[model samples]
Target: MSLAHPAHTPDMINIMIVGDSISHGSSGDWTWRYRFWKHLREHGSNIDLVGPKDTLDNIRTAEVGDDDATYADPEFDPDHDAQWGRPYLTEKDEIEAKVREHEPDYLLVLLGINDLFWYGVEPPQFEANLREFVACARRANPGLTIVLGTVLPCRKAVDDPDFGARVDACNNRLRAVAEDLDTPSSPLAVAETAAEFIATEHTWDGTHPNPNGELRIAAAFADALADRFGIGARYPRPYPDVPPVALDAKASID
Candidate 1:
């Protein structure tokens, strides 16, 4: 589990983002993943974002975009393992393969929302699936660092009396899962997404985040990375805006 060896170079860190829509991002939206990439670039960190998929969700066409969104610097790698509607169960099977393919130093997980909102997965079962997903990643590479994120509150949860409570219960179990999985060589840390992502302020439509919300999410992950792994540099606020770039006509999600 110890990565302090010749296998991993000290200069470069490979990070893989793992999640559903929140991580995949929709067309014309800058995902929290991009924000985190900008944070790394601004701080002069030698990091590479790795994944099998490199396309953004096209909310307009109800398909993958033909071109990548111009949310951050074009130089930043946009690769990640996020899918549009994938749940923990779906990701559990795919995670090991992704780990083997990307060989990332860290996996930043922001899943479970779809499981609860879309699939109606219970909190306990969701937590179990999450644990298995983590185990899959570890089995692929014991030295991999795992950062788990608490689910953000949604506007729809306010209307559904039990939804909000379910989210809270799942978050609590998420923390416990992190604590149970923490090891010196392959440590698990929980990023407080719920605190940073306010349903009213950060999200555009209660589910996905607006641009400002994306920054908050990035800040949360960046702070956790700095605090736990000592990998990221200080992120400056009022992040410079990168104008949207035109997508290629042939660009499509694979």
Candidate 2:
């Protein structure tokens, strides 16, 4: 039931987004994952965004509730494996269980910022953790397609010179890891987000992306999916600052 083809397909592809604050997003803000969802819907792709948790970091907890604080978008399935301030090593076991439960066709991973910045995990250790994380997912689902995202640049890199080098080291190792893990049944690719998401314009506080940044991030994933797996349409940038006029909106008869 994989829609990893070009032609008009009716099958639905299950996708799971896994990361930290960058993926979890805020209460009012739309994450890159959300933008990707919109892109898939617009392109007439049958897909389900799957995850165990459905709560934004700044908005709500993962607990069930009836109030507005409980949901980011009640209509949309806000399920994801994003936990604020937590590294992949901290939640590798939980992520494995999630992969087994959801059985997603694709796993979009955008992590490592916290691991390098907060935890001060060196490049070697970070790569090891990343390798273990991918292994966990593959063990859960042998046919799963894993797309790893490069660690985005941050303003902190200016203050901490070693931070940038560490990020680069991790990304270099990540590319190698992808090459090592790719197979015919299960493929691995890297979504280049670091270059697209500049710390100045794309991010609000040198870390989290604003709306424009979100779109760019989404475009990166979309491009990767379309180019590498042929799963979805590629989304171009220059996203509108204001909402477009509704085609069906009615005007009073004059």
Candidate 3:
């Protein structure tokens, strides 16, 4: 479907999503981000994608249960295949440096699962850190829009029952923070995927999602931006039935 507003050309919008492994496409076939990108391209839009090259400073261990532990000790357990290091941009300085360089038009930040998995940071610290990330990015480019991606629901590890709940809490706090960041007349807005994505069975593992999940995520963010900023949509709103020319299950995704 075409955008509802006056049609925009390819250069009208440029998006850059930043975060941990999720932003890096470790979830599924990186479908979420790619799907969003594909929609824009099909509609004759140009998008500039920016993210890290590798899995830097992401959660390295799987929690068997909610009570498994608070933060994995920063030590490599070769037998268990667990690493002792930290996730990338664990500090604000690193993120600030990167934003100054890229200066993207729209910045999508998806993080904190590693913090939950590793350091067991509570809602307060997580919000504070996320706020810092957002503030710094906005400071670097005043007109830049920000979309905060949420942690996907995870199947309980044999050891963790509260893993999913903790993620919920994180999302809740993020929503509050995003709202607080907005003014009645401000241009900054929030995009949420917690509801749209978690129910789908497209996850690569029980935790990370596959390509379909990614597409949903991208579409959700694009829709959010269109609603809030009046930016033309990348995907056709009021989506219709699949076309015969559409990609097959495997080929479409690839």
Candidate 4:
């Protein structure tokens, strides 16, 4: 559908991140959102991270969200629309309204793993809901560029055949969904999460990403933005640390 995007200046691009718990993140987690935020700022982009929620959920505690921004580094803008345990089926309306309200230039969407794990949504049906979500967003803002994150393999997938199959199938259909829903005005791309992320090592739990996983996922989004959308510099390294190199004159010259 050819929808009208909200008017905005080229000087500043507003972005909103929408997803489930992985993107919402709990206390003490350095979410990939933050990492990508850091990447954009490091590259000197005039961007505004916009959302309705900015609270961290303590998943371990019975109280889900404490309304505290307890990230490892509490510097970047923490605005986001992600909530813990939100069903993929219900996000269409909310996203549409939010898109119209916020009028962001890009939507970084990472969802559906919760649906696969908890709701056991089949690939076809999952794709259908995802398509609807995309249509909803595009209907709100036609110029909005979207990027989808694939379902990373979790610890439960190792032992449970059904869950593993569901994960694999959902991801495959996610790619197809990106291709099918993508348009010239609102291009869609899939973040290279499945190929680059090793959930076993990267995740603190079976599903959620740990620090290392956060960087990988962030890199996946960053690379897609650079390659597909021409947004920012390529993700420099998987880890934050850079080894200091002392090069000899000959080697340095060469």
Candidate 5:
């Protein structure tokens, strides 16, 4: 059985977050996913968010530990293993199955960095993966709310000089995908990150974010969620920095 939630009607705001490292809060802190939940609980009058447990996989290894080692959090299991990293469609079927099993009212997806890093999947594959993701979610729960986090930016991507273009290509595809999904049939929300969130200096390794950077990611995401869901005033200051319009657009898909 799914976990229990506070009192709320069917129309009450409900949310679910799914994705890679950012959703996991890998920067040694509670990411915006949790912050948004906290904000809703503290601020929203009747919104009730539910779904999988925290998305963090603190342990990089897949070791099966003692009873305590059991992944009580449905979002992640100690036994759950990644067959392939980045651009993880290689494991897309598995991830989708897990999310469907959870059956969240609102589904938020934050992924693609690993795929870009691992397979360097071009724009076409990126769109395919996203389409498949949305289709599967809608298939499992017809009325489910779907939110897409634009594949965020990475300074490391600019290191190659050609990397910027690739990132743009990916982001462009994300924008188009978001637009396509936001139809009356599915009620998709595109959590635009490029213009609202992204700190070049805050990045940990040009890819992953440090604590503050994670907050930025969380904030932008929170803002989008609030705007889309019709929740009250701005939830904790969303990543304060808006992305520069002139972010170098030169990287190429290697």
Candidate 6:
């Protein structure tokens, strides 16, 4: 039974993560999806991950078992639909097919950085593209629950003010889109990643997720699902380097 709201949460909850390079991970990285999946298996049950694609970007079949492979747990089910260099416009065309094929109960989406970097899509178009993504997925499965990650800030924000402003505007519009599209049959939650996600500390190269970043992102989506739709138990783990604790002001002087 659904926990609080009494919505249509499936007994065997099928999940798919759709996004760009950050979620797709590189050859030797433990993706946030891995962290999210681990949380699900630990705190929830009857969970089945579904997607057409599995395996990190550019990772070989031979590297799965290597001791130094760097992935936190390479053995976790890697089913997902994310890819490197894919923007929202690209995903807009492909999401419906993947959703129809996987028939997932929930979709966790993290995108927009690539769009700002590569696609020249401003806030208005980004919102439109996101709206279309939700529409297309719903067309495939009307009852699909979705959790959208707000456009997380990155090191780009530090390098370029214009880019940072775009990120902020995109996030603002994303909330509007989520609010506009969310329904009881297809509940939508806007996960709070942008506010607390620190790009430099969390990412290895200021864009991709490091170990701590994975934990933070996973907790955001996991908590959103549990709190909003009662899909999984809350991921109560604390994020590392977050709140960016500072040393005592007078310690150095002392």
TM-score of 3: 0.68
- Root-mean-square deviation of Cα positions for candidate 6 versus the true structure, in angstroms: 8.8
Between candidates 1 and 2, the one scoring higher on lDDT is 1
Q: What TM-score does prediction 4 earn?
A: 0.87
Q: TM-scores, in order shown? A: 0.86, 0.84, 0.68, 0.87, 0.73, 0.84
Tens digits of per-residue lDDT for model 6 on 30-131?
A: 678887887877875556667867766543333322122334456677777777778888898889999998888899999989899988899999988998
Which 10 consecutive residues of model 3 have the lowest summed lDDT? 73-82
Question: Residue-wise lDDT of candidate 1 within 143-248, one digit each (tens)?
Answer: 8899988898889777787999999999999999999989999999988877756778677677887777787778878888988878775456665554333344
- The top-ranked prediction according to lDDT is 1
Model 5, residue 109: distance off in Å is 1.1
In the range 71-189, model 3's lDDT, one tens digit per residue, is 11112110110122223237454656566675557776666677787788777787888788777776677666777766656544223667766777888888888888865432456
Please give, for residues 1-254, the per-residue lDDT of candidate 4 as tens digits: 11112244578778898988888887777688888888987897767788888767765456655555656777777888898887678897689999988778889888887788778789898989888999999999888899998887788877788888988988899899899888897899999777767767777767787777788888888888889977887898637642221122102111
TM-score winner between candidates 1 and 2: 1
User: For candidate 6, what is the total of clashing residue pairs?
Assistant: 0
Output the better candidate (5/6) by lDDT: 6
- From the highest TM-score down, the ranking of the candidates is 4, 1, 6, 2, 5, 3
In TM-score terms, candidate 1 sits at 0.86
The lowest-lDDT stretch of 10 consecutive residues in candidate 1 is 1-10
Error of 2 at 199 (Å): 1.0
Local distance difference test scores for all models: 0.79, 0.76, 0.54, 0.79, 0.57, 0.77
Q: By TM-score, who's the top model here?
A: 4
